[model samples]
Target: MANGLDFFSIGGADAHDGARAVHAWHVIRWLLCGWSLLVIPAFYGELTSTSQGALTIARSLYLCMFAGFALCLLWMLHTSRKPKAWLAHNRLDVTIMIGAAFSAGWGAPPWQTVEWVLRLLFVGLVAIRIVLSLKVFFAPNRLIGLLIAGAGVLAMAGAGFLWLEPRVHNYADGLWLAFESSATVGYGDIAPTTPASRVFAVFVVLLGYGMLSLVFASIAAAFIGKEERALRHEMHRDIKHLNAEIVQLRAELHALRESLTPSSDAITDAEALHSVPRDHH
Candidate 1:
């Protein structure tokens, strides 16, 4: 029963509530976006750092981002009339935030099996949030923008592979591997050998499939939309033509009636002649 405006708006009905909700929504969305972007560098630092100081700084940055994200969620919940409903509506967000916090808090040997698993989970959650945010904020007409964003994400993932995968010597090789994995091409020229790289490949494949599907869908939509527009134009033209012909026919019918029938003036003169007394006798 929700109208488009209401659906898009965070506040349900009240204008004042809606205005506050809108602001909160924007803040939260932007914060989430910033946090998602920062994750790459923060995670890279954690993974690549040799010094304890560098690792601590990276972890601190990540923790700060998580705190900001949590605070945003709290603000959003506070803005809503029904906190429980809001929580229900955004269970995934809440769950991911909780899981991420837990993962970040659980300290393990850096780059070890457990650490890698946690990292994977955190990265996957961030990716999911990015996709979800895109879906919520962007319209289908923004497919081109989404495509560009996808390319950026792909590039970042490639870079991630360059660092995470030992076999990937250069950015180009990592990018090639990412493309191959995402497209499910698996060219066999380069492959992920390590457990971490393989896990990363899995994420790449999933992301690739989603992005490729979106690309195909957008293309198909474009073609279908073009056809629809053409059909609509043809229909409008035909209707207009028919209407003009109808008007012409009406005008012609009126002219034909005038020619076939006696005019008022002529009928009056004919009545006058018939009224002549001598003529009648």
Candidate 2:
């Protein structure tokens, strides 16, 4: 009688399906881009009435930023899913969002609908980026560092609010509020008074601290790790050099001893000549 062995196979065909999820996001992003293009003409009303050319530029930048970032985010998700991938996206995303938020706020007039839209977009992008990127900093020490950075952003934002008395008039004010919310502190003394402002505030509150924390922590950790690695490499190089020097010194010492000592043949010949003198006697 012969026995038979059974083999089993498991798992779905899309082994790295999460990676593919980013591509779907890319398709969604293009659709949004088409919509943004269509919407540009509509912004004429806000641009013409407010006379905020800077605001127009800022708004256009953010729209493009979002689309560009959405594609990059998809690619990032495809290749990696760690601090490296997440931070890479967050770095550009946060910088753009923060800059746009301030530029639009300061450059554009409030009565313009475009200004409000720009603000909302900036807030949304930053909040979303932060929320999504938080997973990269999981360690306790990193978490603490991130928390501090969040707090700093929030503090700056709060100070701006207090300075403006809750009025977000310009980039300075936008920056202040963005940082404050990211810090996780809302005094409510100078809170967002308008509906749009309030909504954006909520969005910032939700994503601010968490996202900033991870970004700060991941950046710090990377720098510290790089520094440590460099130091270790230098130390290793120095140690190797020292070892070679020690070997050379050892060889030199052996040569020195050979120079100091007479050859056995010379000693023996001397003894033979001296003994031959005695034999001659």
Q: Top lDDT: which candidate number?
A: 1
Residue-wise C-alpha lDDT for candidate 2, range 20-83, written one tens digit per residue: 5445544544443343332223232233334556456546655554555556545555654453
Give each model a TM-score: 0.71, 0.33
Highest TM-score model number: 1
Query: For each predicted model, how many residue pairs clash, with residues at least 3 apart or on different chains?
Result: 0, 11
RMSD of each: 5.7, 15.2
lDDT of 1 by residue, 1-281 (tens): 54544322223223344677666776677676676666666666666677888777777777777787789788887886767766655655665567556645556445677767677777776776776666753455557876886788689888978988888999999889988999999779999886557767887899888777777777788889999999999999999999999999999999999899998999999999999878454
Candidate 1, 118: how far from true, in Å?
Answer: 7.0
TM-score for predicted model 1 compared with the true structure: 0.71
